[model samples]
Target: MWPGGTVRDVAGLWDVALPAEAVRVPGVSMAGFRSRTDRFVDMQVVPYPALTLFVDFGDGRVVDDAGSRWMDSGVVGLAPGGARGRGRSIDCLQVRISPLVAHAVFGAGAEFSGAMVSLEELWGREAVRTRERMWEAGSWQERFAVAREMLLRGQSEGPAVDPEVAHAWRQMVRQQGRVRVAGLAEETGWSRKRLWSRFRSQVGLTPKRAAQLVRFDHAAHRLAAGEQSASVAATSGYVDQSHLHREVRAFTGVTPNAVAQAQWLDVDDVAWGRGRAGARRLRVG
Candidate 1:
């Protein structure tokens, strides 16, 4: 019963399965999804802390609002974290890739910020070959295995992010995005300028922006869970309710109330259980 009934609460029209050990890959997590209804569904992707990869196994199409190529079987989509887009009738295995792992697997970290590109564009013909295997897999578990192997291979061969940058990223996540950039620079033994440059180039976002995105993500979930806006603001590190309002509107293009009632948030409760993929932050060794 959203205002004016303009927003349809269709979060229940899909089944979401968390990844099991067979498909487990560090720096990433999987959420398998299958549509229960054939009707067209509107997708409002919230800003997340990890880049997303979508492997469509079903016959339905996923069309984005930005006039990007339509997504279907035989193709996969890669959207950077904090990016927003819409899809329709999506029946896909969505994987959230942590930036720490995205660099090793995808290599082009800076290019992914707020960007969306097809795997074919990023990985070339290999993308086609991989999608073929995923499409041919007899079950979701099999598909997950294929994906896990592919990621493992890429991760093994790809370059690693700088250890200091990795540590800074982890500290932000550990602190729930309340950590200061200057303190992170100090702890990493790098000058503030150097830290900012390296972090931006490797992680695809400046330290402050990354922290804000993470903070906004945490606050958004709290709002969805029926917390008062003012309380969420105070507890989540914002200046006040007004600060929270501005941040929510900046990230989601909606009012605090609208984000609270977002159907997308509602799905997290069911689609993502206790071991929410990418819920655990990465650590620097």
Candidate 2:
């Protein structure tokens, strides 16, 4: 069974938190996850609103559903939001970088949408050097400082995303993905076709898909909080409980009940329990 504020099974458990510098970067938040023991995290990755970067500093390896890539120490794995993977005896610092900030940092936000690639592919050998530095750092605070400097330097080099795309994305996030695409077009003074073309080009997912992801993220956490599925469905803009189920399944390949007990969501309370956004905890029996 799952314990409060932690995700555990045969794979063991992890402790998580956000560093102080994480708050200064817009569209960037870092969650430090340290394994309680040498173990694995086997679960479908619950999609989030940002690019997930794992800076591994532990023993063993991590593999995802899509391929045979085994991410080990001195390796940096990049899973675009929504990509699922597996971790075996993993201990690392996980950073969630919003796609909005991604373009400015990685210089290629559109390339990562719905895909998983190693940070080495994008950052090249710099990925190797950074991982080495992280491992050498004496403490989490020093490690976090190294990470912040690298990202901030990268952020200084690239062009920003279009203001229109930023505005549309902001609306989708603010409404918890409940807003209509046509309304976004109208508000941006762009035709529906134009909005669709541009949003997809820059943001990766189409406007509709992005909104669905945002909605599912909010509802998944609510369900984990022990809210009844039917109640969550009604308030989450679903036509019915079945609609919520289908969406949840589509996003995570799991039932609403399973998502409520997901190890991925369970760790949020402990790892992200405090810091920039404060703590979000839910009791699970």
lDDT against the true structure, per candidate, is 0.71, 0.68
Kindly report which residue stretches of model 1 are placed more than 4 angstroms away from their true locations once superposed.
Answer: 1-12, 59-69, 73-89, 274-285
- Please provide, for model 2 over 1-285, each residue's C-alpha lDDT reduced to its tens digit, 9 standing for 90 to 100: 112222322224455545664334666766666656534456556777676667766553445555555565322222233344355545567777776777777765445576666768778888888888888877666666777888888878877878888899999999998999999999999998988988876777788988998898889888887889999999999999999999998877779998887766766655544211323332212
The worst-scoring run of ten residues by lDDT in candidate 1 lies at 1-10
Please, what is the TM-score per model?
A: 0.85, 0.84
Give the top-scoring candidate (lDDT).
1
Tens-digit lDDT string for candidate 1 (1-285): 011111112244656665566568888877666655665555456777887787776564545445554655322222232333334445577777788888888874566676666788778888999989877776667777778988899889999999999999999889889999999999999999999999988888899988998888888888877789999999999999999999888877788898776655656655554212322211111
Where model 2 places Cα greater than 4 Å from the true spot, the runs are 1-12, 21-24, 73-88, 273-285
Each model's Cα RMSD = 8.3, 5.5
